[model samples]
Each structure stands twice: as structure tokens, then as C-alpha cells.
Target: MAEDHRHETHPEIVKRLKRAEGHLRSVVEMIEAGRACLDIAQQLHAVEKAIGQAKKTLIQDHLDHCLDDVVGPLARGQRRAIDEFKEITKYL
Candidate 1:
């Protein structure tokens, strides 16, 4: 992934992703250890939420910084492009 220095949230997002990675690993262990399904599901949910938050942060930072830097003043077309990009993030 490309890092944009203008966004201060990059490091925070990385940390969140790392934490999610760890949780996912633990979930694997729980499965191997025959942990209760509910317990494993709960941890998996946490991992999913963490990753989702990281993705949200990344997209928001791109909108807040990258879009602004690339387009000084958004024309109607540019605004439409930006809106489309933001719309795509809704699926994330």
C-alpha cells in the first residue's frame, strides 16, 4: 500500500491493521484448540471491525488530503469524480 505522508492517520491505521492481524492469528489458534464457536466468532468480529476501521481511515485520509492536493479547485467534473470515489468507499 502506498503511504501518503500528508495524512497523519496513516500510522494509526497501520497500528490498527497490525492489531487486527494479531487478532486473526489468535482466532486461528482458538479454532485449532477447539474453543467454543461463540468465543471464536467474537474474536473474529473484533478483527473484522478493526480492519474495517483501518480501511475507513485510509479512504477518509485520501479524500481529505490526496484529493485536495491534486485538485486545487474542483470543477463540476472533478467534484463528480470525487463524489464517485467517496461512493465506492461505501462498500468497504
Candidate 2:
């Protein structure tokens, strides 16, 4: 059987996502209101930055807990976990 290695969503992560959602909604409203291109672009940049920060936090958490456990002294599962983390980093 495959090992189940899902990380539970931390409360702070959820809060950050909620705040991002609000920012996204504002961006949508700005678009609908025919706001200037530069203004909309600025808001989009803010949203992207927030998402990037949140992603970094989540990645750090995974590295600390899941990856550390997988890559510890045994080294048996290290390669696979490392490969997975590399794949995930590509998207970010």
C-alpha cells in the first residue's frame, strides 16, 4: 500500500488564504468597474505576492515535518521525497 503523507492545513494558512480571497475579490471588482490597467495590474501583483509567501510557508512546514521524517538517518525514502519536493518547487 502507498503511504499517506498529507499535511493538515494549519490555522494560519487558512487565515492567509481567506485574506487572499478578499484581495482577489477586490481585483475582480476593479476589473468589472473598468479600472485603469495599471491599477488592476498593481492589485494582481499584490495577490501574487501574497500567494507566493503563503506557498513558501507551507513548503517550509512540509520540509520540517514530512520531509525531515522521510529523509532522516535511515535514508530509505529520502530520494523519493526529494524528487517529489523538486516537482512541487517547479510549479512555484
Candidate 3:
């Protein structure tokens, strides 16, 4: 197997996750401060979107680098497995 692609993108991914974490903390603080619902919801939505985008980037980077190297010339069954795995991630 190829070396994990996470090594390449882990720092960037962690930065995104940390930003989302800060956004989440702000959302909690907003709630505690009795901020307007709209403001709180906006921040929460930003947090969710940030985390979602990070997840997508991580998955895409893995597929592009790690899987391409490890699964070169994939057979029929291997391709099906990859497709199914992708399908399952739609819910994420």
C-alpha cells in the first residue's frame, strides 16, 4: 500500500477543523449570551458547513492520491467497492 495521503493533507485538514471548532465554541457562547436566534443560527450553520467541507476535502484528497496509488488498475470488484464506498459517503 502507498503511504497514507493523510500525511500530505493532515495539517490543512486540522486547521479547518480547528476553525470549525472555534466557530462551534462561539455558537455556544452566543447561546449563553442570549444572542438573537438568527445570529446564533448563522454561526452554527457556518460551523456545520466548514466541517462538511473539510470532510469532503479529506475524502477527495484521499481518493485522488492514496487510492489512486494503491488501487491502480483496479479490477471489477475493486471498482464496485470504491463506488459503493462513495455512495455511502453521500450521507456524510
Candidate 4:
């Protein structure tokens, strides 16, 4: 494990989660207020998307930074490229 420098993206991920949390709170309120189903669904979708994007970003950032920290030196020594390693992790 590379000296884990996870703090870099943790703040960003937290911010995203906070936004999702607020949206979820609003959604709960909306439900209690008897808001239209469409309105609730849209807000729920927004919350879902925000969380999903945050997860994807967190994973990609970890793979990009930490994987490079661990594999970059070796790949450089072997004259091999590790971009694919980072790029492919985007699907996770």
C-alpha cells in the first residue's frame, strides 16, 4: 500500500455527501408535506446521482493517486505505462 494520501479527495467526497444529505432531508420533508410524486422522484434522483457521482469520483481519485504512488515507480523503471490502470478503474 502506498503511503495512503486519501485526505486529498476525502474533503471533496464529504462535500458531495453533505449536499446529498441535504437533498435527502428536503426529500423527506417533501414527502411529509404531500408534495407531488414527480417532485419527490426528481429530488430522489438528484440525491441518487449526487451519491453515485461522489462514489465514482472517490474511487477514481484513489485509483489515480494511490495506484500511481504504488505502481508508478515500477512502471517507470520498466518503461511501461500505467495510465490504463488508472483509466480502467473508472468503470468501478
Question: Highest TM-score among the candidates is held by which one?
Answer: 4
Worst 10 residues of 2 by lDDT: 70-79
The TM-score that candidate 2 achieves is: 0.66
Candidate 2 ranges with C-alpha deviation above 4 Å: 1-9, 74-92
lDDT of 3 by residue, 1-92 (tens): 89643457778889989999999999999999999999999999999988988898788677766776877788887689886776677666
lDDT of 1 at 9: 91
What is candidate 1's lDDT per residue for 1-92, written digit by digit as tens?
A: 99736568988998999999999999999999999999999999999999999989898888877877777787897688877877787777
TM-scores for candidates 1 onward, in order? 0.75, 0.66, 0.70, 0.76
lDDT value for model 2: 0.78
Q: Report RMSD for candidate 2.
A: 5.5
| Clash pairs, model 2 backbone | none
Alpha-carbon shift of residue 39 in model 3 (angstroms): 0.3
Supply candidate 3's per-residue lDDT for 12: 86
Candidate 1 wrong stretches, greater than 4 Å: 1-6, 74-92
Q: Candidate 4 lDDT, tens digit per residue, 20-73?
A: 999999999999999999999999999999999899988888777767676556
Q: Is candidate 1 or candidate 4 better by TM-score?
A: 4
RMSD from true fold, candidate 1: 3.4
